[model samples]
Target: MAPTGIVLLDTYLPTSDEIAAILPELIGDMFEPPDGIAHLEQLRLTAMGRYFRMFGDWNPNPVSAPKLFVRPGDPLREHHREVAWRAGWPLPHHSADVGGNHFTMMSEGAATTAEAISRWIDALRH
Candidate 1:
């Protein structure tokens, strides 16, 4: 929460430009489909829009439902873990990290992620 006690808002970040600019530097650790650069470019505005425009007055601080924060295990995304831990979700909040970059985690690491989910589900059930 911000000083106003509303949901914390980011006025400065969520720039796709910065991520696009740094892709080459992080190439070794990324997985890409055909025409990845073009795909990124095609998605720049829409991707940035979620933060750049749409989230002006949103509140997610009191997320009531159980939270399952499955984070992408990209080195660049390590902050996700810190954020999740800091968010301090409800008692049964669960989290895990599967290998791969954010997008790649959907493909290359999907099985691992799925297994993590299944385990979490089983744990909850038990």
Candidate 2:
């Protein structure tokens, strides 16, 4: 699910010139000191051109509730947590701290993660 989100975000990012126009104020540190408004404008145009040509109006996912297979140490997990909190959810049904970086953790802990997800999926199936 999170991977899909990243893909979507990346897809939208290049085309989000309107959104990026405000990014300098929000993330002023992205540029070094003495950076001018032209830099920001350039960034907007670049992102708009990249994104506009990259993604379609819609994605191809079949389900609204996206499914993600991610390790606990993955940075995206934190983003997922933030989104869940912002949505006012009480808690996530399942998450585990599998040690390692993204690829390492996925390789080492795929079975455990799959088992955990299978449990939830099976419950829903019944």
Question: Which candidate number would show the highest lDDT if scored against the true structure?
Answer: 1
In Å, residue 7's CA in model 1 sits off its true spot by: 19
Which pairs clash (backbone N, Cα, C closer than 3 Å) in model 1?
A: none
List model 1 lDDT by residue over 33-121, tens digit each. Answer: 34222244536646655654664444335545444666555534454343322222223445676776555656777798778777766
Off by over 4 Å in 2: 1-71, 74-99
Please state the error at residue 60 of candidate 1 in Å: 1.4
lDDT of 1 at 27: 45
Q: What is the lDDT of candidate 2?
A: 0.38
lDDT of 2 by residue, 16-113 (tens): 44334433433353344232223346776677456557653433444434343333443222443333211111122233344443333445656765
Query: How well does candidate 1 score on lDDT at residue 78?
Result: 53
Best by TM-score: 1
Per-residue lDDT value at 16 in model 2: 45
Please report how far candidate 1 places residue 123 from its true position, in Å: 1.9
